[model samples]
Target: MDKYPYTPGHRGIETSIAAAIDINPKLGRLQRVSEAAIRDAGTQGLTADELAAKLGQDRCSIQPRTSELKRLGIIIDSGLRRSNWTGKSAIVWIIAPMLNSGESPSQ
Candidate 1:
C-alpha cells in the first residue's frame, strides 16, 4: 500500500474531495518531479511560480506536492522572496540542507 504524506481537507465540496482522492495515487510521483525541479534550481532556489513554469505544470497541481515536501522537511523556505507574475512577493523554496556530522535533521 502506498501511504501518502498528506490528504485533502474534508471541508471542500464533494467534487473537490473526490478530485483529491482521485489524485492520491499519483502524488508520490508528482512530488518526486516537483522535488527534482526545486533541487535543480540550486542555491538560487525557486518560487512556486518558477517551479510551475519550469515543469510546465499548473500551479494548483504543484502546490499540494510542495506542501507535502515541506511537511517532510525535504524543502524549506529560503527566507527570500521574489516577485511573482502578478507582482506579488512569493516565497523561495530550497532543498533543505543536509545535516553534518551524521546528525539526523528531523531529530
Candidate 2:
C-alpha cells in the first residue's frame, strides 16, 4: 500500500472546489465568477467595480459574494493598502491550500 494515495498538484484547491461546484450549478457559477475576478486582478488588486466589470456582474452582487468566498477560505486576501482607495478595495485574492484528509499543517 502506498503511503500517499494522491499526488499533490499545484492546481489542487481550485480543481477540487471547481469539481464540487460543478455538481451544484449555482455554486459553479459563483465560483467561476469569483475565480475570474481574482485572475483578472493579478497582483495589482481589484476594486469592486473592476471585479464586477470583469465578471459582467453588478457591484452589489459581486461584493457580498466575494466577501462570503473569502470567509470560506476558498479565497485568500492580502489585506494590503491601496494608493487612493478609502476602503478595503485593495485586497488581493488567491486560491489557497487544500489540506489532505486527516492532515493539517501548522499555522
Candidate 3:
C-alpha cells in the first residue's frame, strides 16, 4: 500500500508518513495484529488506546491500523466511548455485527 504525507503539514507528518511507507511491507501484519486484539476483546470492545496498551504498541502505530480496518468495514463503532488517560473520550470499536455472533433469533 502506498501512503502520502498528511497535508497542511505542521510538524512531523512527513516523517511519520515516510516511516509508515518504509514499513509498508508490514502493514498486513499490523492490521492482523490489531484485528485480533479487537476481536478478542469481544462484546466489551476496545478503543485504539486500549488496543495499543494491550498490544504494547504506540498509539501512532496501532491507531492507523484500526482506522484502516474500520474503513474496510472489518469493524464498526460500538456506539460507546471510553475516556483516555487524558480523560478525552474515544470511540469503542467492535467486530462488525454481521461478522460476529451469527444472527439474532426470535424463533
The C-alpha TM-scores of every prediction are 0.80, 0.49, 0.78
CA lDDT for candidate 3 = 0.77
Q: What's model 1's lDDT at 100?
A: 21
For candidate 2, write residues 1-107 as lDDT tens digits: 21111111123588764643443435447556776667556665565556776778766556555665555555556565453234553655554444212233333
Write model 1 residue lDDT over 1-107, tens digit each, in one string.
Answer: 33445553334789877878877777778888988988888779898888888989888777777777887788889999999888999989988886223445577
Once superposed on the true structure, which residue ranges of model 1 sit more than 4 Å away at CA?
Answer: 1-4, 7-10, 99-107
Task: State the lDDT of candidate 3 residue by residue for 1-107, as single tens digits.
Answer: 23321211123688865876666776787788988989899989999999999999888777877777877677889999999778999999998876675643211
Best by lDDT: 1
TM-score, model 3 to reference: 0.78
Per-model tally of clashing residue pairs: 0, 0, 0
Predictions in order: lDDT? 0.79, 0.52, 0.77
Between candidates 1 and 3, name the one with more favorable TM-score: 1
User: On TM-score, who's better, 1 or 2?
Assistant: 1
